[model samples]
Target chain A: MFASIMYKEWLKIRWTYLGGAVLGVFIVFEIFLNLGQIIEFNKANSVWNYIIFQKYLFYSDFQFLPAFIGLIVGIAQYFPEIQDKRLKLHLHLPMRENNLLLSMVAIGTVLLIIIYSFLLIGLSLVTLIYFPYEILVSLLNTVLPWIVAGFVIYFIAAALFIEIRWARRILIGVIAFAFVSMFYYYMGYDSFNKAIPVFTIIALSLSLLILLSGYRFKRGTK
Target chain B: MLVKTSRNILILFVIFVLAIFVPDFYWKIFEKNIRAPFVLYSPVIHDFIISKFDDKTMVRMDNEGNLLTRDEYEELEPLFFYRQIVMTGKMPDSLDGMEIDIQELRRNNFSYRIKPDAIEEPFIQLYPLLESKSGRAKLEMPDEFIRLQNRCEFINCESNEVVEDLSETFSKAFTDIGFKFPAAKIFGNPTTRKPFDEGYFITDSAGDLFHLKRVKNKPYLKKVNRPNGVNVKYIVVTENERREFYAILVSEASKIYLISYNDYEFINTPIEDYDYRVHELMMRGNILYRSFTFSSDDMIRMVVTDREYNKIDQYDEEWISRENTSAGKFSKMVFPFTLSIIDAKEPFINFYFLFSDTRALIGIFISLIIAVILYLRKKIKLKFIWIDYIVILLTGIFGLIAVLLVRYEE
Candidate 1:
């Protein structure tokens, strides 16, 4: 039952992962435009320039596109269930509600990681044209923050949808986006600096709690 | 059902409080950054034009105390046209009798007869005037000539004559009232000569009263001790050979009085119409003759000063006399360093510090908003998701700790 639910969640998120890949291609194309400028200036040969270009590609507009796709995927995972009132059907199933929630979150998290992996690959291909093995390693280290950011947004979207039961999810999501945007505007990027760690711990704790809730539901059914 | 509702309400309340108060708490912990008063830039006005091209002819005063023409003053302009005027200088011990005579001649357009016997040892002593014992000591001089010398190291003697005369008059009045220099022991240091304490007894040839107190220390002299009315202090006196004019830099130490170049009645007749244009012109044309006055309580009252013109048609008359309190105390307490990294062009690491702190706040707000939306949508279907709560708790705690670590590191 858990496998089936997980498969269903994966089906919901597969397009989002594809969309992220497409977005990654566009980012690489944009990065090439800048690289052309560097090549003209004869500054693209060095590993540092390559690293800088990679950093810009990952951190610039490309970073948000992936996160945005992840958010939509996260929202789409439950929106259909809420719309059809099919969430109540899960209660009738022998499988625990906590198990169902865990499967959904796990699937959502895995989808984001896959999306981020594709983005990393895209960055690697573009960076490989100029960067060496060591610089690629450094660039890989920088990608950790973006990946963490993706997971964070996924978990937050899950939590928000689980907490609020109406179409207001989109509204709440937009408001959340606006609030975060304002903070980013004032504070700058690297919101992951403090936020990523917090999100990690929260996701872990929430996963455990969902499992326990499922266990309780199973016991009640028995 | 009520119990569940209450529990949810309690959870929401806790989240709300954390969301609102956490940022402020974090801000309070790192209040040092917000309160730190860093200097954006130092007031260093380098180049300036003096007058219109037509009237731009430089004037100078010859040795015979006459305003020489532009042709005569051509050779003298370089002597007075300083590439750099060093405001910071060590106080000279004393001025010679000849120097005093020269200063007097430059200031008054008439030379004073200096008797060798009349010359007295010039010293500074601190005198406490207020009952609170918070009075500043003044440096005294025999006459206005000595006073100008004591104020500025013979920089602008002519413009300082008015201030010197005022100090001489006041010092004589104070001395006649049996106001002796407070004992050296009162300052707690006997060997070190406090420049403010030395008062010159200004007496006529027969030692008659010319009530005046010459203040050698520019900072102390710039402070107005009067409860009411304006007090002028001599900043510098320089003899300009190019202009053939003796320029004296003076500033009012009074906070209450506004320094204006409005036409004052000369002998009950309006000397000139109240023209801001001319006042602005005079203020601008005279670059070396600027006044910066502040209140007795250290509030900057005004800075009515001139700046050099960079263009021929441009009249850059910068009279920035702001009545604002000095942020000295706040800056000292919050930002200890005179040269802060915040003013640097690159500020690479500092930028990271500010960015990280701001990002932390953003993260918290974003997480909260997302959580609220999820809670409202019932998408978070984990019935009793203690793990999510614990995760949130841990994240908040860790974020807070990280913020604290950065602040303490600073």
Candidate 2:
């Protein structure tokens, strides 16, 4: 039953996921080219100095890609379920309503993790071309919150879309905006290192919020 | 049961967001910018002169609370405003039985400032080990930079490969001096804009201080014997032309010291109750006196000493900080605690909570009353929604707003 549900969710978002993967690669490639050009135009040592002392981020172009992909994948998966009450039909299957709702969120989260992992690996490879292992580690630390924000947004979309009332949906949306903006407050490299664990836990907890919205939907809440 | 848990989580999340944003918004409307006066010691008058902005005008006064004209203030601080004093032809030939030379004054005049943010901010660990004596007119950055991890490794910036020969030579040199591997903290200027290079001052895993420099493509390592019982916290290397001191050191005990060029002696400056984590320390030097000024949010302390580091005079003053002002007092009465994710002292993003005093209980009590009225108006049973009341009692206005927005059905 879980496999069938996963397949159904995957079918709904397969094109969007593939598109996000391509865009992620394209942005990473652009970063690669820009870094090579920067190194060529200036001395390599000065590039390192600029990145180190001046706090320049070589992969800033990839900052918002995950959030954008998360939003789009979220909308792609959930927007259709609400049109013509398609979720009402899906909930009638021979499974627990909470499991049915959570399975959808679980599939979206796993897909986002896959795409985010691919992008991180690509970024690591590009960073290694000019920098050392330490730079790669800091880069990962710096982007961990951004990746978590992707999950947060995806989970919020699941809740917001399935919610039966406009006022509650807007409330969820405003709160989600407030919560997600915290992840993008960039102070410097690895500024989010200490907060990543807290952010990840909060983001993971948000996934269960969809069950409340699903319960409202099941009860025909106005 | 799962739905109820989810709903409670939603309420807690909203409370968290409100706690951070509500106080921030309140401060945005009522915040005040209070500028501290810039105080300088005068050699001629032998008193501290103060200059500050007051009601869109600059006010100059002496420590004795006597107002002075602009020219009079300039004349009083000839050593500090030498250009203005000399331009006005009021520069004295000699103040303390020595001939005044512009060149000497220019060389002796220096200002060094260290803030809590600069001390705690994040930066890449990699540093360029410039050649101290490249014999070139202009200093050039070295082809490689050093990373002091488990061992000293120098990787060429262009090739991104470790120079095994140079790495081993420096690694062996580090071992020869009984320096441990894996440095805990490395401090250096790391710029070619300075007059010279003083390499890096590294603290080993055992907290021993070691100075490493590259002169003529070789390693010069020195294990500094810090004063016993002094644990070094931060070092600001000054590669100045005066050569009087190598760097300024702040110890873990909040004591400040100068690493004098004379046999690497630790000259302790007479500064009392200085916590480097919260204060801004500014050191100014002239030919006759060295002034150490450190200030926190509401107080400023200036200690003037002779060239021998003897205490000459001191100035201390306090003003009401923003949090202590009338608006601040009202805010305390209204907010149980203020939450912030960014702090000026640390680079990491984490929750910084400032819990208000007993006055906040007034706000919490009012918030509890509002929540009770709200629940009664909505016809919600108190027994089924007891947690909401507890949250309101604890978090005050933030919890009231959260529970209201995320209404629970009984």
Candidate 3:
């Protein structure tokens, strides 16, 4: 049943998932090219000093790509389900309603994890070309929260789309925005190192929220 | 059951967002700005002079509470305002009964400040090892940088490869001095703007301090003797032309010391009560005296000493901090706790939850009553919705908003 549900979701979002992967890799490649150009014009040691002391991020261009991809993939997967009240028909299957809703979100989450992990490896290789493992660690620490935000956005999108009422949807949207923005509140490199665990838990917990919206949709609540 | 748990999670998430933002906006609308006066000790008057903003005007006063004009205030601290006094041709012939030479005053005047944010900031471990004796007219940055991990490895920038010969020489020198591998903390001002390079003051894995510099393309390594019972926390290296000290050492116990050039002696500054994590330390030096001031948001303390580091005079004053203001007290009655992720003391994004005093009981009590009234208005029995009341009792206004927005269904 889970495999069938996963395939159904894949059919709904296959194009979006592939396009997001391409865009993500292209952005990472652009960041790598920009760093090479920056090192070409300036003395490499001076560039390294600026990045070290001034907290300049060479890969800042990749900051918002994950969130953007998550947003699009989420909308692609869930928007059609609500277009003609299609979810009402899908929920009548033999599986439990909660499992059906949670399984849908779990599919999206797994896909995002695969993409985020691949992009992280690509970024690490680029960072190591000119810098050391120490810098790569800080880069990972800094980018971890942003990746979690991508997952949170995806989860919230599912909840928002599946919700039955506009007022509740707007409420959830506002709260989700405020919650997700916390992940990008950067002070410096590796600023979110200590908060990543708590934030990741919160981000994962938001996946359960789709069940409440699904319940409301099932009952046809106002 | 799954639906109920999901609903509760949503409510809790709403409460978390409100706890961080609502009180944050409240303070933004009603916060008071109170600044401490800048205090300085005068060599001529033998007392402290204070300059503060009184409304829209600048007010200058002495420690004895005598008001003075701006020029009179400047004349009192001749050593501090020497440029203005010299331009006005009112420079004193002498101060503290010693003849004052303008050149000596200019050379000896220095000021350095240490803020908690700067001390606790995130920094990359790469450091530039500039040539101390390049014999050039101006200092230039080298083409390589050093990473002191298991060993001191200098990586050439253009090739991104380890310079094996230089690395071997420096690593051997470091190991010969009983220095442990894998440095713990390294501090230095790696810029060509400085007059010279003091290289880096690094702590090894064993927590012992070592000074490493490159002179004539060779390593000059020295193992510094730290004061017994003092563990090093941070060191701010100053490559000043007047190199009386190598760096300012902050001990793990929050005590401040100067790594003096005189046989690497540790000169303790007369700041008996200072926590470098919360208070800011500012040091000013002139030919005759060194002044140390450490202050927080609402309190200021100034200690003046002779050039030989004896505390000759001191001044201390404190006013009501923002948390004690009227608006602050009223906020406690409205918000049970406030949440923030950023701190002025540290450069990190971590939760900083500031809980209110017992006065917050008023807010919680009022929220519970509101929740009960809300349940009654919806024609719901209060006994069935007892968990909603408990949420209100704990989170106060934030929980009230969440419950109202995300009520349980029958």
Candidate 4:
């Protein structure tokens, strides 16, 4: 039953997932072009150059792509199910309501991982060509923090959908705006600002707490 | 219905208010503890001193061990105000052998103190002296030009007797152009290498104690001693203002040899329109190793070598000779602002002034654009309300400004 539900979710969002993968590749390619231009024009020599380039590459685009895509895909994933009362149909199924929500979260997570993986692969290839061997190790270290931030955004979106009913759209929009703005303000310009990361970690932690708390089963018919 | 709606609105408003105010409060607390005003003041003074001195100055050290004076030092006395600010706290125990305590003088709750050590006495003394003398006279003096000589000597002495000895030596060096110099700190050993036939050689002024050998009629570096002393074979000094400086070459025969000052002039050899092979040979030899090359037009090209020159299989020709070719160019561009807010807990008023750089402004612009576009798109679709826009814009502006303040500063 879980397999079928997960498969159904996958089938529903396959096109969006594929589009995200392609977008990831395009973004990585653009980043490579910018990095190459910088290298060519400036003639960078030190290993730190590649590390800094990778840091900016992730800072400029990686977080935005996931949150932007996640909000759009996340809202669309649930909008039809909620509006058509198809979620009510799921209540009649032998599986628990928690399973349905978990399945949706699982599917969204899998898709995001796939897209992010594509970006990583593209970045790796470009970095291999342009940078020295030392840069590969630094780039790997640089991307780890972004990867953590991406997961935080993904899970927060999932939790928000479950908690808010009529105002889910509004809440999601607000959350998305707030999240992206906070990321830009804290990580982008103020990367040296130590508080920004602390705040982000706190926000993610709270979101996770709320998600875990919101997991109780609910009976059908208001 | 109205009351319920107002209550919900009030709750949301409160959350929003707390969100903005809480972070500012936290930043204030953080700033109070971390930002050391004294430490910050030190670098500023250091930079000011270095800039006024033209980055590098040739210190004339007489055989009697006194650094010569420069006229420019006296003219720059007024600029030492920043250094005074750095030395404001509890006085460091020593300052050029003068025993002094900087006790804060308080009258009516106002306190201030200036310890003698706070002012680097050597630099302080030299500043006024340099101002009174002509540049020619300053250059000629053997006691005045030693780089950081007075400060180093002053700080090393333990007893008043030692301090007196240092002071007498310094005063004699200061007054006499040629004093049978006192004992000086020898940077490295002056011993010569092998091959007794290689003529009389003296160690270079730069004081690198490495041994050099001629292989296939070319000087190649080989490691002789490790874990004990550095093995510096070929010493090259290239002056930006002049084409020549003295270098000491150590041959395999443990004999010190002096390469004429003119031999170091290969650094200024105009590479423009020159044979590529000549450039390559100059780069390969210890003559021009790790030196920057400049064209007649002032385009700078820095030659970099890996730890083992063997790691570089091929050199990027365009990268090596391109205009404005120094590696620091990119680093400078990317990190435009060296000022960073050391403490995040400072109040917004205190922190805002710190974001006074072009790079921070650019970051704020990018972040705002992203927030506004996201907020507007959601609003148009009736997916989000206007409040979202307000929250995002405020967060974007404040967050960026805050970040710039905390992270961007050196």
Model 3 global lDDT (CA atoms, 0 to 1)? 0.90
RMSD (CA, Å), each prediction? 25.4, 1.3, 1.5, 25.0
Q: Residues B1-410, candidate 3, lDDT per residue (tens digit)?
A: 88888999999999999999998899899886787899998888898999988866789999988999999999999889999999999998988788989998998899989999887687878788999999997888898889888898998877788999999999999999999989989989989998788999999999999999999999999999988988999899988789899998999999889999987889987778888988999989998899989999889999999987889999999988878899889988999999998889887899999999899999999998888777788889866678888888899999999999997876
Between candidates 2 and 4, which one is better according to TM-score? 2
State the lDDT of candidate 4 residue by residue for B261-321, as single tens digits: 3422211222233222112122322211122122222222323222122221221122223
Query: Which regions of candidate 3 fall more than 4 Å away from where they truly are?
Result: B382-384
Model 2 regions lying over 4 Å from their true place:
none
Q: How well does candidate 1 score on lDDT at residue A207? A: 33
Please provide, for model 3 over A59-145, each residue's C-alpha lDDT reduced to its tens digit, 9 standing for 90 to 100: 899889889889999999999989978998879899999999999998999899999999999999999998877788889988988
lDDT of each: 0.36, 0.90, 0.90, 0.36
Error of 4 at A7 (Å): 2.5
For model 1, what is the alpha-carbon lDDT of residue A172? Answer: 36
In model 1 chain B, the worst 10-residue window by lDDT is: B34-43
List chain B TM-scores, each candidate: 0.21, 0.97, 0.97, 0.22
- What is candidate 1's CA lDDT for residue B255? 19
Per-residue lDDT over B76-127 for candidate 1, one digit per residue giving the tens place of the 0 to 100 score = 3221222211122221222221222323323332111111111121122222
Backbone clash total, candidate 2: 0
